[model samples]
Structures are given as C-alpha cells and as structure tokens.
Target chain A: MTDLDLSALWVSVQLATTTVLVLLLVGTPLAWWLAHTRSPLRPAVEALVALPIVLPPTVLGFYILIALGPHGPFGQLMQLNLAFTFTGLVIASVFYSMPFVIQPLQGAFEATGTAPLEAAWSLRASQWDAFLTVISPIALRGYISAIVLGFAHTMGEFGVVLMVGGSIPGQTRVLSTTVFEHVEAMEYGQAHALSAVLLIFSFVVLLAVYILNRRFPIHAS
Target chain B: MSRLVAQFDVRYPTFHLHLDLDIPASGITVLFGPSGSGKTTLLRCLAGLERAPHGFMQFGETVWQDETTGRYLPLQTRPIGYVFQEPRLFPHYNVRSNLLYGYNRIRRDMRRIAIDQVVEILGIGPLLERRTHRLSGGEQQRVAIGRALLTSPSLLLLDEPLASLDIQRKQEILPFIHRLHHELAIPVIYVSHAISEILQLADRVVLLKDGSLVGVGTLNEMLTSLQFRGSFGSHRVGAVLDAKIIGHEPQYGLTQLDFSGQRLFVPLQPSAIGESVRVHVLSSDVSLVIGRSHSPTSVLNVLEATVQEIREISQSSVEVLLDIGAPLIAGITRKSLVTLGIKPGDSVFAHIKTVALNEEVTD
Candidate 1:
C-alpha cells in the first residue's frame, strides 16, 4: 500500500473508534429514553434520530456541513470552523452511524422490560446500580451488535465525509474517500487492495455479531 | 406491635383503587382478592412501585410515603424485600450472584440474615452454582424468596410468588414460605387470589373487591363473616379451625385433629402427631341434626354446638353459624330450619361431611 493509502486506513480506524466511543457515551441515554419514554414528543424525537438512516448521505452531509460551518448554529456555539477537518469527518460519521448504534440498543432495552429493573430496585439497588448491574448485562447482545454495526458503518462512510471533510490528505482523507480517489485516477490496483480490505473487514465484523448473538441469546429461550 | 398504615387512591382511565388499611407489622398478612380487584395495585403502592397521587404509608414509625407531608421514600430506599410473581432472576447471573445482589448492596450492619441462613431456609444451597434459567419453577421461586430474604428487609412483599407455578410446584414451595414466616421475624405482605394459599399462610386477611377494601380481620373472622363471604366467593365459604394432629388411626386411615378440646377425624395425612394444622370445613359440607346421635355413619365428624346466628345465603339455603369451640358454618335448606325449628341459641349437632387438613400450614 502507498503512504497515502496507509494514512487513510489509519484515519478511518481512528474515526470509527472515536465515533463508536462517543455514541456509546451519549447514545445510551438517548436510546434508553427512546425505549421507555411515553412523552408526546417521542415520535418527533425518534423520527429526527432516524433521519440519517433513510435520507440520502448527501442530504445529511449537506445539513451537517452547513450546521458546522462558520456562523452556523453549532459553529457559532463552538466558535470554530470545523468544516474540512478530521473532527468534521467524525461529526458526520457520528450522524451517519447513529441509527446503527441506537436501534439495536433500544430494542435490547425494550426486550429487557421493566420487571428485572423493578426486582432490582426492590432488592435495594439504586436506579443507576440496577441499570449497570441488571439492565446492561441482560442487554449484552444488543451492545455487541451496536458496537460492531456502528464501527463497520462508520468505516464505510464516504459521501457524508466527502461533503464535510473534503478529502484533505493526512487530515481528513479516509479509506473510502482514498479508494474513490484511486478509482477516479484509474489506479485499479490500489483501489482493489483497499476495497478488498473493507469487504473483508465488514464481513468479519458482521460474522462476529452473529456468533455473539447465538452464544448469548437475548433470553433463555 | 407496630402496624403498617396505608391510604392510597389510584385512578386510571377505566379503573380506580381507593383504600385505607391498617395492617399488623408482624405475621403473614394476605392480600386476598380476585383478578382486577386491585390487591396487587395496593401492594405496589405500599412498595412504592406504583405512585398514588395522594398516598400515605407508614411502617411503625418510619414514613414510607406521605403525599400530605410530601415525604415519599422510593422502593430502593424503603428497607423492604419484594418477591414478584415470576422469579425475575437475572439471566446473566448464577443463583448465588442473584441472591447476593441485594445482600452486597446493603450496609454491613444492615445485613441481619446471613447468606447461609437464607440458602438453608429456602433449601437453595445446591442451586448456588447453577444459572437461574436452569432452575425448576419451584426452585426458582425458592431462590427468589431467598434473594429477597438476604436483604434482611423490614417487610417482605410476596405478590403471588407461586401464581405462575403448577399445583404441584405451588405445593412444593408453600412449605418453604410457611417456614420463612415461622423462622424470620420480618413481616410479610402476601398477595394472592387463591383461597388455599390464604387458608395455609394468612395470619391476617385483607379482602379487596373492585379496587375497594371489603374487610380486614383475622383469617377466622374474614372466613366466617357473611359480609366477606361474598368476597371469598361461594365455593370458598368455609370455616378455618386451628387444630393439632393428636393421633393417627392407621387401621381406618384416619388422622385425628384436636381443635381446642374437640376432636375431628380426617383422612390420614403426612403430618406427624403434635403438628399444628388448619382444618377447613366448607359451609356446604355441614348438616344440622336436632340431637347428638351415636349411630355409625359416613360422616366422621359430629360435634354438638349452639347456633349463634342464622343468615339467609340463597333463596333455598340458610347459613347456620354454629359455635362448637370454634365458629363453624352450616349451609342447610331453609325448609330444614323451619322443620327442625332451629334458631339462634338452640343447641344442635353439626354433621361435617368433609374436612381438609392444611398440612402445609403447620409451624
């Protein structure tokens, strides 16, 4: 692999890892709320969270680009120009891969139901303690699925990263964007190498998810 | 004796539950009612699992919930143990870890019941290493009860712990629950619509009907009262007599139960001599005789008693409340009442046809 290809691969790995971590830290509470809440605005919030799943990547990328640009809502709040940077790529990947992380988690939490949690509470476990000890362990399969799918989906990000990150070499270029550049330049050999890497990586991640699911089923049945 | 005073009024779109109760803190207080009767809802309110808008609950001196004063203690902080209808054991943990989940969380000084004691009492020692999902229904319920007991709670709430089990499994777990009440000083509030459970476990009975408190009294009072008989339903209308197995007549396959100074013979039971038992005599199973007779007959129990009250039960039937060392009800035809000219304060002989020995109730 060329130096630029290796750098892009490293950048992709870094972005996927960072995005998965960020999603777990923030998305857990959001998914939990979505799973159990009965608020009237639940549908609206759920629709908004699920927008990236159905909307075209360019559409989501366009909005994210405008939102993070100078003088935009998020840009003014942060007081920085994030467009065309690696951080910008991360933000776009997070948006692109959110449903992948939240949906599975929300399903798992819903499957867990409130009985075990109430039992835990009756046993003197605090709400936080019960979630960590009871709810999380029971939802282990969902967490595994969420992590794998989120990572793989982020690794394959192209269109959103392109619009927001602009494929700046060493700073914002990733494996998918680099492969696009290779194919555009008629470098099929390098393109094949990178594409094969992505194909094998995604397959392995999905396979791991299935195996884990079988080993630790959601319930005894 | 401290009491648990609770007043809660919960309302939903189609159902409403309004009750104010004073339950004795010790002994097994059975919340008895039919489905959709709000018995479970009342239990939930006491546990703080369901929030009533203007509820007040106090256990002894500790205030659990008081909407008037705005002091409410949540379930986790209430110092209470709850065993749900389902085992509700954590699928991720083994039986040992599930039992210790609450034990490990409470303060060191608050740990009154040791793990070994709970395991021994519930007979869950062999199940400690096994996963919860692998346990039998009866064993799982035993483990669940053990887990709650390990918390050393001030009050234990059992919401039909045996409701999901088969009859054999319920029979298997009843003795363990009976033992918990005897060995542990912790108060228990048990909820069940099963009359057999009430006969076997309840020291006090609180009857609910359509989200309202029907009545609360000792098991004997509630069982014999005409007001609460409707709540118990017709088939369950009977008298519960506290008795002890005095002797066994193996020749005839009969066991003799002594209620006070009176002796009642029943089919041979597994319980040993001197063991206390509850004899349930259904009202429909008793017949009235004008005088005591010594003739041999199919009815093994013939006790002389004075009629305390005669209440009309149905169009053709009248329930004759008899005092034969204990309160016993006899459902006889109104024609016989007129034929024999039976009335309150008249001495009569009660011919009991069938008697059920609640062997699981023995302490």
Candidate 2:
C-alpha cells in the first residue's frame, strides 16, 4: 500500500478510538438516563438522540459544520475555530456514532434492572461505587457492543468527514474517505486493498463481540 | 433496647400502605403478610428504597428519612444490609469477591464483621472459590447473607429470602438464617408470607393484610390472637411454646421440653439439654379429655389444664383455648363440646397429638 493509504488507515484507527473514548465518557450517563428516567421529557430526548441514525449523514455533517464554525454558538463560546480539523472530525463522528454506543448500553442497563444496584446500596456502596462495582460488571456485554459498534461506525464514516474535515492528508483523511478518493481517481487496486482491510477488521470486531458474549452470557444474574 | 420507629403512608395507583411502627431493634422482627399486603413495601420504606411522600423514620438516633423537612438519607449511607428474594449476588465476581464487595467499601476501623467469621457462620468456606452462578440456590443465598454481614451492618433487611427456593432449598437455608441473629445480634427485619417461617424464626411479628397493619406483638401474643389466626387462615391457628430441653429419651426417639412447670414430649430435637427452643402445636392436633384416663393410649402428651376461652370457629368446629400453665388451643368438634359439655373455668385433661420443635438452633 502507498504511504498515503497507510496513513489513512492509521488515521481511521485513531479517529475511531478517540471517538469511542469520547462517546463512552459522555454517552454512559445519557444512556443510563434513557434506560431509567421516568420524566416526560424522556421520549423527546430519546428522539433527539436517535436523529443521527435516520437523518442523512450529509445533513448532520452540514449542521455540525455550522455549529463548529467561527461564528456559530459553540465556536463563539470557545472562540476557537474547530471546522476542518481533526477535532472537528472527532466531534462530528461522536454525533454520527452516538446511537451505536447509546442504544446497546441503554438496553443492557434496562436488562440489569434496579435490584442489583439496590443490593449494592444496601451493602453500603455509594451510587457511583455501585455503578462502577456492580452495574458496570453486570452490563459488560452492553459495553462491549457499544464500544465495538461505535468504533466500527466511526471508521466507516465518509460523508460526514468529507463535509466537516475535507479529507486533509494525514490529518482527517480516514480509510473510508481515502477509499472514496482512490475510487474517484480510478485507483481500484489500492481501494480494494484498504476496503478489504476495513471489511476484515469489521468482521473481526463483530466476531470478538459474539465470542465474548458466548463466553460470558448476557444475563449476569 | 433501642427502637427503629417509622411512619409511612405510600399511595400507589391501586394500593396504599399506611403504617406507624416502633419495633425493638433486636432479634428478628418478621413482616408477615399475604401478597399485595405491603409487607415488602414497609421493609423497602425502612431501607429508604421506597421514598414515601409522607414518611418519617428513625433508627436509634439517626433520622433516616423525614418528608416534612425533605431530609432523606440515601440507602448507601444507612448502616443496613438488605437481601432480596433473589440472592442478587454480583455475577462478575466469585463467592470470595462477592462477599467482600461491602467489606472493602467501609473504613478499616468500621469493619466489625470479619470475613472469616461470616464465612464460618454461613458455612461458605468450601464454596469461596466458586462462581456465584455455579453455586446452588441455597449456597447462593448463604453467600448473599455472608456478603451483607461482612459489611458490619447494624440493621439487616431480608425480603422473603427463601420465597424463591423450593421446599428442600428453604429447609437448607433456614438453619443458616436461624444462626444469624443468635450469632451476630444484628437486628433483622425479615419479610415472609410463610406461616412456617414465622413460627420457626420470628421473635416479633408484624402482620399486614391488604396494605393495612393487622397487628404487631411477640410470636406467642400474635399466635394466640384471633386476628393472627384470621390472617393466617384459621386452619393454621396454633400456639408457639418456648421451652427448655430438660431430657432426651433417645431409646424412644423423643425429647422432653419443660415450659411453665409443664412437661411436653416431641420428636427428638438435635439441641442439647438446658438449651431453650420453640415448639409449635397445631390446634387441630389437640383433643380434649373430660378427665384423666388410666387406659393406655397412643397419645404421648396428656396434661391437666383449665379452660380459658371457647370460640366456635365453624358450625361443626370449636377452638377451645386451654391453659396448661402456658396457653394452648384445641380444635374440637361442636358435638364433643356439647356431648362433653366443656366450658370456661372447667378442669380437664388435654391430649396433644403432635408437637413440632421449631428446628431453630439458638447459639
């Protein structure tokens, strides 16, 4: 593979890994809330979280581009232009891959029920301690699914990175965008090599998830 | 003795629980009731799991909850251990780690219950290396209890810990629970609808029926009361006799119990001489004799007693309460009542057919 293609693959891994980390830190509480909240705003909030799944990637990318632009609300508040940068690509990927991380975590949290958490509380574990010590271990399958799906989805992004990050070489030129660039330049040979890597990597990730799930069954009870 | 006092008024869509209680924080106080009776709800309220809008609870000196001032101590801050109907063991850990989840959380100086002591008391040493899912139902529950104890909780709440188990499993776990209060002396609020459990384990009983408090008293007080009988269904009406093991006739496989200057015989108890135990006698198992008979009979227990109260439970059956130092009830036919003409203030011989030694081993 050419050095540019190798760099694109490396960029894809970095972007997927960073996106997964950021999503987990932000999505965990959101997913838990979605799983357990009784507020009337729950359905609306859920609908908002799910918008990225059904809405076109270009549309989400367009809105995110504006939000991170110099004059937009977030840009004005931070006073740092985030558009067309690695950070911009990551922020867009976080929004793009949110449902992939959140839905599984929410389902697992719902399945875990409140009994074990209550048991932990009764045994003198604070709320945070119980979540870390009890809920996290029991809902491990959901975590696995969330991390894998979020990473793979972020790796496969083309339209969002194209709109927001603009395929900057060695900066935001991820594997999917590189594949697009190769196909556009009629370099099918290099495109096939990178596409095969993406295909095999995705297959390995899903296989790992299934194998882990089989070894440690979903119901921890 | 310190008391755990609570007042809760919770209204669900279809049910409401209104109770005001001041119970001694010693021994096992059972919350006994049928399903939908709010027995579990009361326990939850005490544990702060259910935050009743109109509620106030105080354990010893700490005010755990008070809705008026909006002061509510989260359950984790309360020094209490709660075991649910299911074992609720942490699935990710082995028995050893599950038992120490709470133990490792508290400060070193605050750890009163040593892990070794709980393991020994619960007989879980053999299973410590095993995963929780690999353990039997009874074994899992024992580990759960051990986990709670290792936290050094001052108050323990058990909500039908045996309700999920089958009969054999219940029997397997009951003796372990019987050893708890005797060994540790932590006040336990145990919830169960099983009459047999109440008879075997309760030091005090709080009866509930359809979200209302029926009565609260010592086991004997509640047992002999008509309200308890009504709640328990009349057929379960009986007396709980606290007795001392005076002698064991191993040749005949019988043990002798002494209660209030009266000697009673039951199937051999595993307890030692001078050890106190509780015995249950079903009212249906007793028959009255007009006078002391000299003829040989299969009945092993015959005590001279005076009649106390007679209530006609049915058109054909009458429950005759008798006093043989301690109160005993005999369910006899109305025909016998009329034929023998038994009434209050009369002297007679009470023939007991069977006696159940509560299988509780006091430490």
lDDT of each: 0.89, 0.89
- Model 1, span A1-221: residue lDDT tens: 99999999999999999999999988899999999999999899889889998999999999999999997899999999999998888888888999999999999889888999999999989989999999999989889989998999999888899899998888899999999999999999999999999999888878877987788765541
lDDT of candidate 1 over B215-266, digit per residue (tens): 9999978888877776666677888887889999999999998876878998
Off by over 4 Å in 1: B287-306, B312-318, B332-351, B359-363
lDDT of 2 by residue, B253-274 (tens): 9999888887889899888999
Instruction: Estimate the overall C-alpha local distance difference test score of candidate 2.
Output: 0.89
Which residue pairs collide in model 2, if any?
A: none
The DockQ score of candidate 2 comes to 0.69
Query: In model 2, where do residues sit more than 4 Å from their true spots?
Result: A216-219, B287-298, B304-306, B310-318, B332-349, B358-363
Residue B349 accuracy (lDDT) in model 2: 90
RMSD of each: 3.0, 3.2
Q: Which residue window of length 10 is worst by lDDT in model 1 chain A?
A: A212-221
- Residue range with the least summed lDDT across 10 consecutive positions in model 2 chain B: B354-363
What's the distance in Å from true for residue A41, model 1?
1.1
